[model samples]
Target: MKTNRSMIRTALAACGFGVVAMTGAHAADTISVVTFGGAYEAAAKKAWFEPFTAKTGDQFATESYDGGLAKLQAMEQAKNPTWDLIDLETNDAINACDEGLLEKFDKKTLGNTSDFLPGSISECAVAAMVWSTVYAYDTSKLKTAPTTIGDFFDLKKYPGKRGMRKSPKVAMEWALIADGVAPQDVYKTLATPAGVDRAFRKLDTIKPNIVWWEAGAQAPQLLADGAVVMTQAYNGRIDDAVHKDKKPFKVVWDAQVYDYEWWGVPAGAKHGDAARKFIVASTTPQAYADLSKYIAYAPPRKDAIPQIDKARLNDLPTAPANFKRPLQIDAAFWADNADAINKRFQNWLAQ
Candidate 1:
């Protein structure tokens, strides 16, 4: 995953506006695409997917995946890419692109993607929604709230079994941030040995308190079951979960790490142009605004945020105040550093 500039340029040159003809008919055929089938997925379908289909007379099938990357890899290897387009977590998108498993994006078809936050849109992928890894706690259990990564690590003062994303990216940054690197310097700190070692050491102190969660939905479920009093979770999932399950989970979006879920077409896809059109359709201001309200992930499209509820809008990771303390993830940075960093992260986790 070490994407050097020369390598990136070479890859881009190799892809050259990669567009392909439609499968059957000319200019009148119904296009096909796939997406995750979740509650939020269903929201996306109702708000945009089905509407796109109806408007264009194209049919789409939304599929659910508990493990999207593994499934995408298997599909790619099998040479049976059933999905034309699929959604991915930030790290997963990077992982797939580095392997050349996703097609280079159709930038010409995208009208105002620059309206998205800088760097959120990539050559092989485009972020569909942005969310946070915030300190979500049961307000009823704690007297005072923890405000920063340092406070979260001080289990003695804010003692509880804590849960975090089992993924390498944010979890490691959080560990480093808690170990004394400032929020702004977290990645710079991880780019070195001593900084990374200090992070693992800090993590070791609470390793026993860790309840590792792999699913986006599992974080809040664990909190509700009292498996952990506090956990780093997706703001939308936690908010919906606590409200639905009658739990006291309240999220304070201070010093949160923002991550995005992306849309990428598989490499050698049969329906590339149609997929790109679908991506443009789905990520538009109108569609993204409606989807954000339901999914709770903020749209990277600047105009999309204003269209959402002003009150709930402030709770999002993209909120102006939240952005002051927040760190915008560098996907390319992670795309390049993933292999080494993840291996070291795994080694630490194994210990």
Candidate 2:
């Protein structure tokens, strides 16, 4: 999707000093925005936060949190919510909306919902980026390169420690895909009891060789340090390591599961008006494009694509070459099944 540069300029111009327009007159001077820290935060500050601040004269108090409901729930229970905006994963946003912990959005305020990739905008959230969980190998270390998702599971052929997230989310999906389940059928197959068993059976084959990682940065570090030959990593992290750090890394995009991260207002936030303004400023085509320049995450809006530098296009998860065999994450499925599957995964991990 390509956005008209003129249209973007007009939209941002209209947003000038509109921080007081949300709930009117009671907006706070400072708003706290929560996000996962690192390159993502840095990009957001440059593209959205700083611009918004400069335009509105509103101060931002930034907070970092792993995407989870624990802190949100605690704030809600205490009836003392502090966070004005949240950067949430699709599943977390869905869950937060369901639990009445997030404020619903007005579609008109965020531009036309149709302009964004389908399934990216919700009643309570608007997409910030489309990112993927892909595996990468150190080219310097691997004698033979892995080309497919199945290759990630081939312990005998690769013959080295595999780096994987400690969580079961993407791991289980990759396992099913490696076991010959088509990307289209992955969720459907996992929905059945037999299929769940089949996925676990595949995962068991390389369990002993797995070196578990819990953070996004750890995956690239693991590869660089030779702690693991290949690791399930966020595509942006691997891209940065290769492009900026010049690490000898290669991403295997086949069968990658890509999904959206959203910007949403927490329910009962003190600075609701300012938060809403920030959301509008941040989701503009210009803002989204600016972010893509700083990080590898794909903007959710179709129009924002054209504004991105062409050289960086191949690194995006949404790039046509990488996206040809993509697996769009089914957040609804995970929201419904995560508890049960996570328990099962924990048990399997212990074994």
- On the 0 to 100 scale, the lDDT of residue 248 in model 2 is 95
Query: Where in model 2 is the C-alpha error above 4 Å?
Result: 1-28
Q: List the residue pairs that clash in candidate 2.
A: 1-302, 1-303
Model 2 CA lDDT for position 40 = 73
The estimated TM-scores of all candidates read 0.82, 0.90
Q: Report the lDDT tens digits of candidate 1 across residue range 120-183.
A: 7887988788878787888888898877777778879988899887867777777777776778
Backbone clash tally for model 1? 0
The local distance difference test score of each candidate is: 0.74, 0.87
Writing each residue's lDDT as its tens digit, candidate 2 over 133-245 gives 99999988888989999999998899889999888888889999999999999999999999899999999999999999876778889999998999999888888788778
Model 1 misplaced stretches (Cα beyond 4 Å): 1-39, 57-60, 64-71, 242-246, 270-273
Clashing pairs in 1: none
| lDDT score for residue 72 of model 1 | 73
